[model samples]
Target: MEFAFDEADAAFRRDLVDFLDRELADGWERSEFGLGSAVHTDFSRKFVRTLAGRGWLTPHWPERYGGGGQGAWQHFVLGEEMWKRGEPRGPQYMNVNWVGPSLIKYGTEEQKRTLLPPIARGEVFWCQGFSEPEAGTDLAALRTRAVRDGDGYLLNGQKIWTSYADGADHCFLLARTGTVADGRRGISVFLLPLDTPGVEVRPIDGFVGDHSFNEVFLKDVWVPRSRLLGEENKGWDIVRRTLAYERVGAPRYARAALVLDGLADWSRTRGLLHDPGVQEQFGEARALCEAARLLVYRVIDERAKDKEPSPRANQARAAMVQAERAVGDLALDVMGSEALAEGSRGDAQFRNSLGAGIAAGSYEVQLNLITRLILKLPKE
Candidate 1:
């Protein structure tokens, strides 16, 4: 297949690169804190609004929703550039990538009117309430409940590993609206306002860093029936499809490749590029990054063609995790003791690589999907 970008896409990339260079010429170092950091989030709020002003924040969404009506490839191109520059858009990436689109597809007309504009304007932050203390990975087993109460639901439960919850305005939350034995069939999605009464967000200190993860608790939080997304007891289908887009949403391999370039520059400056083992490792890491990029592009190509979401997305996500880990390892090998320094490129890469495998879905879970779907293997 041809890999060359047409003139318009090439021009778009050039313009986007120029825009990033101009906007991030100073103080962009704050983004190195990684997504969900107070530093990163603060910078992103302003940066995303700037992008929205330029009509680039949600370019793929329809024009009626305040977007530019661009295609998926344009959005993917934007993501690649942002991720390569360490994703200065912060949590707003989710707002454009899957959250707003999911709302467009499943939200009520009134909900769409109320919510989509803020996201398109880059005026809000949203956190996903997916993982629970006991229900991570195996999401269908989640126990967070939303009981019927008059015309609304009373939500009560806890969600862990919730990124960006500390400063979020709303949550794309999932809860069990039916019995536990109903598995995936029991779940529903809620567009929960974080400031609602009885809602609490507690920061969790972890390896990824402070403000990156939190535990969100709900105690008799009242949510109007109008807040429910899609249909009750039918959220699993929406989650599945949303995860498909999300799997390749971040263009993580783009960041991995950029990190690899930095590692190479570091090696060359230290005259370590001449080492045979170091050279070999560099070659392998570069190969993995390129492989991951191509795999992701394949998934994006399918989306551009409007093909059904395929197991190829799972394969692409798995490759991205491997690519990130490989580059992270290479940084440690090249940087030696300096790699341990906080905020160092190697140190940041290592932290990001650790989260890459676990976020969205675990690497092991992606392998299970590839085996069962791509390889057509029977379950044990």
Candidate 2:
């Protein structure tokens, strides 16, 4: 169980870091106009294309799918660097992380031929349409329906808190195809094009930033059978695997760790590092970040070995949420008023930490999973 990176992986990280230093020389910031804002997405579209050109966008995918055919550790390295630098890839992270892989696993050949290339080229944006007004953490409760209509299905429902919907070209949607009594069995996954008729995207103002959330309305939106991912009424398995991939997708601890370093530097510059209280805060936050990083690495190791995603993914995601929250708290405690400035590192970290607890399944949900699956505790 060697934890250190081999020379090849370490060299890849060095090259990636150098490239990012040059690319983000202007100090890339996600807080400038929010992630889904025109300004941010426009930058992401261009930046990701550049990454694609470097064969860095989907390096872990098979080469036939337009990836570099690299190992999973290499892909994880890319994620850590991107997240630390504020994830310039924006919404495309979903495409590379799970969306494309899900398609590769379950999509028809035509579906793969049509969709995989665009994602590999970084020419598209995608959003998840899983969360509904009635189904946030309880995704099986989603009521969005897709009824059989000739060769396609007519979809009607609403999805809320859809991140980056304003910039996405397509949606990885979930809808109920079976009767309401079926619960999770009733659900189906759809690769829906946003331009389809009767689909509307409405922006929602959110504390994170403008356009960070949206309401996606589907009123008799027609999707061809070709767009259905895997088998209808059997999407729960796909969702489970997709969620596993998503749990450690963002590498939030990398950014949190980077934020901790910044705070330490800030403290040192202001002679605040001498204070025992501030010192303890920084040390604790740093420890949390390291612990979270190692937990995530455990999950990635499973992935590298092609193991089924386990409860460790849930534990890793929960640890990342804690690490982010710890660093966010340290920022405000040590930097005080300076942490409150709009678009500042502290402000951005605080907002990201809030989202981290909720995204990729909430922290509480992860604990429930840990209890049931890892600890093998009976359900309460």
Candidate 3:
């Protein structure tokens, strides 16, 4: 259980730090930018292109796919730095993380040729069509259906709480290709164009922020057979693998730690650092953040070693949510009314905390997984 970074890793981290400092010099804070805001998304488009140009984007991907062919740790380092700065790459992070990797693994040759380059070049935006009005954590219950047509599928369903759907060029969509009773076995993944006929995106304003979520309606939308990712009706395997990557992708602990630093700075500046409660809260949040960082590192370590995925990913994700919520709570407690104002650091942390628990599967779901899979506990 060696935890120290080797020289090469340390050098890479230093270079990444320099790159981020140069790129985000204009007061970039992770919490200040909303996920769906035009300012953030637009900046992300350009910023990720820059990363691609510098060969920083998709570094962990195979070199044949326009990546640097670096290891998983490098990719994790990039994610941490980007997340620490509020993920300047925007939605493109999905491209580099699960989507592109899934495509590389499961896509047909032609599909990979057409899709992988643009993602590697940071030229596209993709939204996930996973959650629905009725099916969230219980994704097997999703009702979105893609009935087989002559040479394609006619998709008719609605996806709710879809992030970046309004601006995304494509959707990593899931639809039932079998009978409803088939449940998880019935699902398939589609690389559907968002602008296909009968597709509609309606914005939903929620606690996170404007443009953070959308309701995507597909009324008899059609997709060609070529767009199907992996084997038809066997997408459950693809989805499970994708979710495994997504569970710990963002390095949320990095952002939480940054928020803790900001809170400490604020406390010191306001002559409140001497307060015993504030110090104690900061210590607790800091400890949680470190715990989360180490837990996520363990998951990454497993990936680097080519080990089988385990419930430890669930543990890491759960720790990250806990750290985020702790920091959010600390921000509100320390800042009080000032934290309530929109766009403030405290407000952003609070919103992030709220969303962290819900996004990428709920905290409760993670606990259930840990109990069943890790603890080997019997269900009542």
Candidate 4:
């Protein structure tokens, strides 16, 4: 349980820092929840390809898959440096995070052959389709349906709040293949080309949504049975497992840590850091951030040892309340009057922290898991 990085990891961190220095010196996102949208311009896409060429884009994956084949610590350190630099993470996220892993784990050998290399090369863009209009938190309650047809399945219904749908080339999806009465029991996971005939993506606009999501409709869009992941009706199991890995998303704790650092720096410059009241607030936030870092490390270690995070993962989510809220509150403290600015850089961090609370999983549910599920408390 020594929290210190061993020599090997220390060297790996140096390698990561050097790589970041070379690649992101031009500019990039540095936090896990790094602020702002991608330029998504041609220049940006080519810049991502340059990362691919350097073997830095998918560093978490094995080398055979066009990655650096590095360990989690190296990946974590690389992310820390990138977000701290205020640069966008680029397409590396969808590839190295969970999209490619899920496909590699559950896809057919042919499917893997077709999908993985392209994703690793930054040739394709992907988005997730787990949450439906009615089935976000209770994923099993999803109402999107898929029915067997001639050579494939006819997909119908809609997916809401799907991130990056407007730009996605494909989506890793969950659909109801059976009766709603079957609930989580009847759902299955599938992959779809977003431009498949009969499919429509409608941009969802709101004053505050930041355009990260969309409403997607599938009007008999067909997917070949070759696209079904794992066994039918057993996708619930895969979904659950996949999501555990997915939850990391390069570790919210790491990026949120940056926001906290920014707040501390601002406070010190403002002389608020010397006040007892402000110091207490900073100390509490710092404690939670440290706790989150340890909790995440435990989850990684457990996975490396081939165990379910289970209660530990639950604990990580619970601790996220402290981290995410503290970042949001930290933003208020940092920007003060500027926290309300929609276009200011500091205000952008505030908005992003506000979004972080609801993204991945809402903090409210995490609190319930900690108090009710983990502590074994009776429901109110």
Measured against the true structure, the TM-scores of the candidates, in listed sequence, are 0.97, 0.97, 0.96, 0.89
Model 1, 12: alpha-carbon shift in Å? 1.0
Candidate 1 lDDT over 139-197, as tens digits, reads: 99999999999999999999999988988999999999989999999999999999999
Q: Predict model 2's lDDT versus the native.
A: 0.90
Q: Write the per-residue lDDT of candidate 3 for residues 57-166, one digit (tens) a residue.
A: 99999999999999999999899988888889888988789999999999999999999999999999998999998999899999999999989999999999888888
- Candidate 2 is scored at a TM of 0.97
lDDT of 2 at 231: 95
lDDT digits (tens) for residues 1-380 of candidate 2: 57799898899999999999988846575467445567767888999999999999999999998889999999999999989888888889999999999998988899999999999999998999999999998899999999999999999999998988877899999999998899999899999999999999998887666457889999999999999999999999999999999999999999889878877888899999999988888889989999999999999999999999888999999999999999999888887898989878788888887788887888999999899999999986
Pick the winner on lDDT between candidates 3 and 4: 3
Q: Which ten residues in a row have the lowest lDDT in candidate 4?
A: 27-36
- The CA root-mean-square deviation of candidate 3, after full C-alpha superposition on the true structure, stands at 1.5
List where candidate 1 sits over 4 angstroms from the true fold: 26-32, 208-210
> How far in Å is the alpha carbon of 168 misplaced in model 3?
0.6
The worst-scoring run of ten residues by lDDT in candidate 2 lies at: 25-34
RMSD of each: 1.4, 1.3, 1.5, 2.9
Prediction 3 global C-alpha lDDT: 0.90
lDDT accuracy of residue 189 in candidate 4? 89
Task: Name the TM-score of candidate 3.
Answer: 0.96
Residues 55-164, model 4: lDDT tens digits = 76677777766667777666666555654555345434655577787776677888888888887777777878877767777787888899999878999989887777
